[model samples]
Target: MPDISPLLALPGAVAGAGTTADHYGDLVAEQRMLAAGRAIVDLSDRGVITVTGPDRLTWLDSLTSQSLATLDAGQSAETLLLDPNGRLEHSIRIIDDGVTAWLLVEASQTAALAAWLDRMRFMLRVEVADVSQQWATLGQLLPVGSPPLVEPAAPNGVPLVWHDPWSAVQVGGWQYAAEDGHPAAEFPAVEILVERDRLAEVGVAARAGELPVAGALALEALRIAAWRPRFGGEVDDRTIPHELDWLRSAVHLSKGCYRGQETVAKVHNLGHPPRRLVMLHLDGSDALLPGHGAPVLHEGAAVGTITSSARHHELGPIALAVVKRSLDPAAALVVEVDGVAIAAAQQVIVPTDAGATAGVPRLPRLGAVQRPQA
Candidate 1:
């Protein structure tokens, strides 16, 4: 899992699932330190893949959901690799530095995703390499609208700072979340790429109280509060960007042909996504957090499934669930966690009528029947 033995030696550090730290003795204090920008989270479990060659940007643009053909140096964007059916396969945090495109993704996805990309590079000039072993990730809270402050630039001179674009809609993107007061409006966070060998330095500093360090759990809480859809947690084999409001940042509606662009356009224009995403405020009377894949029930019938849940420092228990689009927007739901049903109130993230095409002209359906009386 990325060999976090260096961090495990630190006081209060506890091993967490999937190469993460569960907490640092006091989770609440760790979260507070993170929110206040006094601590950073070790995200060594994340992976990095670098693509080089002259055709890198254009080749990638032609394949993924985002428009990357014109990406400039230091530009950051998120893209989705979709299957032929438009199901999400991979979600990449992209940054180009004039020479190479660095794709940051979940650690578990690194090997498979890299292998897939390598096979796709048949005649193209692009060269893909998994650089995860050499690079690690660090995350921290930042002031809203502020950039990450990294002293020494990445070896590629790219800074490798992904200032989350979730705060606002990009030029060619759309937001399905409530626009008046999106939760992500105040969720300021960033992930910075650092040398893998240097993680020990960070751990030492954190233990000495020089550089405050939090656990991945704190970051999860903040991400859930922001209604952010993570790749491994919120996505499934049937997931489309439309279902998770991912178009808000990842997809460019007018982008040219890609593998799954047809479905993207079709659903966005005339059809609604089969499922919709919601933020659930869980009843925390029992002080329990629903597990991922927990069944979300409406009137005792399964209507959705919780993708991720967390106990926020301030927000108590919160979760992101994907429910059937036909379900009532205000339906009172219950999440079954470990055989215990917990009350859940929905906060609309993807509206019931999300993906409605406003002005797009409709065309007649094929095979019109003409019945004549003889």
Candidate 2:
């Protein structure tokens, strides 16, 4: 039988197996590293789909949540592919390189998305191709400004140029070319991928060994802390874009018609979303926090459900909850998972106030005070 050990190693990573995923044993070692410290995750497991041709921009704009027309060269945006019923099929990062649009998404979703897009193509001139094998995906966190960043040369090459607050970038493919006196003839242009490989090169001495594999647990924790919402957790068939606060990142309201546009507009202009996403502090040991879909209770009533959970080394356990907007943030809630009661406290990370909607919070104006009549 073909060696199945490499796959086994990933789950055994928490136990400290080995340096490389050279075999099943090594993968186990990799997993341990990922859970404990910082591990450079080879996101090759993710997928890349390229959309090229004259109608690429227009075609994408008609489908996704973000405004594509305004996406200049070297910039990128996160968008969602939603079913006609408004359920999320996948969450994608759209990178515009001035030549082609590249979508980064879960590997499992790639084939389905490509097929969906192909079916929609009638008179619109566009070509969709899966380029997963041609590209290698890498991720890492590194000190900012380690190397002077260069923009993608191709017009449609770079997408979403803004820096992640954590100073990481998800990039595709690595090229080797002759250049000035650098140790490596060619290095990864993307910061995250470069950092990961650099860690591998230096090994334990450079703190590479300390980095743990960022499993789903850790990834969920980081995202929840950043107040980012995942598509599958926060979105569904009944959800409109505005309901999940997606308008802040996705959804160009001014853009012309697309599927479910009517419901999105009507809900935003005429009413408030019935449910909202919020962060919760789960009061318990790391092991007690409920997993996803666990019910949230307020007093004796069921208020909402837990969408995600994570155990921070410093903060104990925490979770993201979807609850009724009318539910008081001050109200006490509990997450009961597997017979363990995890206490929860709600926090409004994304404010629903009108003042916040206007833009940056305005500070009080200070000027010479005039004496007022008593």
Candidate 3:
């Protein structure tokens, strides 16, 4: 993870500490060009994992939250690993190409995830290995109507390209967002995994002005606009799929029991999620953007924390936060950035009543009996 990207040497490349360049001087123009499929983002900070053996699919399906038993070759999917109490642990972007299943994940998470998968192999025919040293990941816009700007790597006879599953709800997924509008489909991303040598060639092409390179910040802006909840930004020890409306993409409600299946089922079918995710439209008059984990204040009361924030090309300053589900959606909010409280307007992502979908009747405690569902 020691700044592996060759694009770091590009002109105007303001490389982040131990990460890729944040921008090529102008983030706005970077976003525009990247969104048009004319540029690519250096995602070298991400890591790659590969699973092989005939039992790979079922082994993964039995261990994670996705229904991967039927995942077809060349098909794209996503899955999550959770603690026993159903807290967010790791989010994986998956693509299987018959012979091997490729996993793209945060570099910080690669070692732990691979180690855990290795421990769980227990008599199974599957073998897990961290192949990050042998591969490179690059991200680009591949919206539905257009062709890819560059081809993906398929060293094993199938390209290791993972389409963003957030584009639509999966078959076993359920959506709890109160609003009908979600812009996820507009940000069609395809993760390309190439051999290390091939990426070196891309770096050469980039230096020759043949391959336009946009920084990770540009892609992050578009991701924020799409209302996508990234594991690195939104996920925490207490995060549950229900809180982020992640059920819309990552969770398979009906999948066979995984480690946290009970909590996931109980939260979705019989109880409400304790918190809901919201988007805050910040007042940019101060020209200050709140960093991640900034305190979200509702009338001077610390109600929640900002997870991710970005200045969209058109929307200006915006952020995603998780707040108490009971808080009024119309409530005016403030985000404190370095002790300066910035006024923010709230936009709903998940509603106050996002769960209990089973509609099971609840009985009153002791003498006071509640009415049953009719």
Best by TM-score: 3
lDDT string for model 2 (1-374, tens) is 11111222453334212222322234344434433334544444456778888788888988875578656666667666666655556777776666777776666678888888888888988999887655434443322354322111233334323222111212211111112332111111131212122333333322333324443344445456545566646655566554455555566666766676665555565555667777888777646767678999988788888887766545657787778777886888888888777788887743343112224454556885667879
User: Relative to the unseen true structure, what is the C-alpha lDDT of residue 351 in candidate 1, on a scale of 0 to 100?
Assistant: 87
For candidate 2, the per-residue lDDT at 59 reads 89
Per-model CA lDDT versus the true structure: 0.85, 0.55, 0.87
The regions of model 2 sitting more than 4 angstroms off are 1-39, 83-87, 141-216, 350-374
Residue 178 accuracy (lDDT) in model 3 = 51
TM-scores of the candidates in the order shown: 0.94, 0.69, 0.96
Query: Mind giving the per-residue lDDT tens digits that candidate 1 earns over 1-374?
Result: 46653666688888888676877788888888888777788788888999999999999999999999999898889999999889999999988888989899998889999999999998999999999888887888888655554342466666777777787788789887778878886677778888888887777777777777888888888888989889989998899999999998999989888998889988988789999999999999988888889899988999999999888999889999999998897788899877888999998989899876755776657887766879
Better of 2 and 3 by lDDT: 3
Candidate 1: worst 10 consecutive residues by lDDT?
144-153
Worst 10 residues of 3 by lDDT: 143-152
Candidate 3 contains a number of clashing pairs equal to: 0
How many clashes does the backbone of model 2 have?
36
- Distance from true position, residue 240, model 2, in Å? 2.7
Per-candidate total of colliding backbone pairs: 0, 36, 0
